[model samples]
Target: MRTIAIGDIHGGLKALVQVLNAIEVREDDTLIFVGDYVDGWSESAQVIQFLIELSQKTNCIFIKGNHDAWCERWLRTDTVDSTWYLHGGEETMASYKDVSLADKKAHLEFLENMPFYYLDDANRLFLHAGFTSMHGVEKEAFETTLYFDRTLWEVALTLDKRIKRASAFYPKRLKHYEEIYIGHTPTTNFDSDVPMNAANVWNIDTGAAFKGKLSGIDIHTKEVFQSDHLPNLYPNEKGRNKN
Candidate 1:
């Protein structure tokens, strides 16, 4: 079966629908969404609804993202953490004005139960962010597997002094298991439209929430489909604003 991976949808439901229609995914094929499914746009609730339906429509896997994690916390407690809101949770919360508590709870459970990482028989690992290899560290603990790998990052920050210690840190070590597909960190490096590296590790989060574009990669063919949203689509420029 053909496998396709879609990047962060954020809350751009229009872009999401366009990309899906463009792909023309078949029911027999498998589609894996690499998280950040909500936030950024005004249709967070609609996005969640679409995903729920899509899950039943075919063989699909919804991996959790850092944004997805905070969304759950916000829905459950009704208070958002600064770190979470800073990364698009605000837009998500603002989008859910009509959804019922029952629906929200169901969505929250779906978000919370999301797998941090997925490893195929061929060793292809699908994670929302990064991975950490340590004893007793559940795939969920890496957080980076669905958020960011702070521990590995903290070590990277100490490079000057760390280099003196004679030890090397290679986040690439996770590559040994199988290729990893990640999101969260946008491939675009601020203002640039170019996507980040996806060779050794497939990073599908093409910054759809930003001025860049939304992308989906066909795993088998390694082909990428993207949708751009630069010029305003709405006449008054209401929700047509870029993320």
Candidate 2:
């Protein structure tokens, strides 16, 4: 049974399907989604429904992302005044505009219960954004794992770097058991595939919200699959130079 870790979907159900098709997932395999399931695209409802159904079919680990947290806040409070509404929340809401209140409540409940981080026996940690010093069920109750910023990213990055340096310095006696798999940050920021030692804490979020490609990574093998709509989807750091 292989483990496949997919990056942020951000409501791009079409792109997700394409990646799934490319992978040929099996019932015995596990699929870990890095979060940001909603917002950006016009298929938030579809994305949520897909997640619910997928969880039942396979060993699916759903980690909450910042956008997911925002959705939760909006749902639990009935107020759309959070940062989510400002980002891609507007698009997410539009997708479910016709959904019934009952259905919306059910979806929200599902999101509320999702884990902030998932740790496997193999020592791989799956988190949406990243994990802060205050993770686990205790602190996660207040802030979703998806929303952790510098606290999580920096420490994780530092630890990752240390591990790599150690491995390069001592290949035979490698340390560190956990491989951090994170999303929220996009690969577009860097030139090469982000690899923190064997712990490929990849940021496959090619920025679908900005029309970037949707990406998925296969753990163990370290192979990556991406949507074809990469170039046309999002504008790069440099604003569009349209004619």
Candidate 3:
């Protein structure tokens, strides 16, 4: 009955599978994926298919990512922005070149239905990116910000919680959750493969889209599970090595 929050998969199905195997999910356990499930490696379609199947066997929450939004657009219109293609969309489309119509439809529906954010009884916020300010997921404005905002993480990284408590200039609702878990900003930016926490927010995207591993953490116990570096799993691919 553990609650696990997984970082971005970014089409690294092998890494995703390795982390899942390590988790040994139980019947009542819940899995929360922070999104970016596609647009990297060569198995974006396979990753979606696995997730579609996994949803039937276990409790799972899939949060839509910016990359996923690109996928949704392409899935529906069959055309997408060149920016997406440059940032791994080509590989993603290639992964599904031979996919069945039914599978693509299923994947499309899945992406379309994905919520921007998820909250639990423990008051933990799970999102793909960052958010401005919202009490409820329904009240979210500009859903893309949930997967694109960097300001929140920057504040979390620099803000002193004690000063925040004492400051009258800041809103009382500055942090409305016990913990916030996000995945858009990779922890690798901080030169770490493990999860990084600033204030009460946790950055778990350990750059699996690049030369890093896929990571998953037990939200309640703080137990972490990580897969091998994706470049090793995908020897022929360069992934997203920022120049």
User: If both were scored by lDDT, which would come out higher, candidate 1 or candidate 2?
Assistant: 1
Q: Which regions of candidate 2 fall more than 4 Å away from where they truly are?
A: 134-146, 150-177, 191-200, 230-243
Write down the TM-score of every candidate: 0.80, 0.79, 0.94
Off by over 4 Å in 3: 134-139, 161-173
Please give, for residues 1-243, the per-residue lDDT of candidate 1 as tens digits: 789888888888878788788888897988888888887767778888888888887888988877787788888888879976766676777889888889998898888888877777887877776656642125345355547653433333333532322234544454355466777766664443443443346667777776657788887788887776622322232332434
lDDT by residue for model 2 (149-237), tens: 53444454445445553465422211233466777776544543333322344555666555466777788888877775633443342
Q: Which ten residues in a row have the lowest lDDT in candidate 2?
A: 234-243
- Residues 14-89 of candidate 3 have per-residue lDDT tens digits of 9999999999888999999999999989999999999999999999999999999999999999997899999999
Of 1 and 2, the candidate ahead on TM-score is 1
Q: What's the true lDDT of residue 41 in model 3?
A: 94
- Which candidate tops TM-score? 3
lDDT of 1: 0.70
Minimum summed lDDT over a 10-residue window in model 3 is located at 165-174
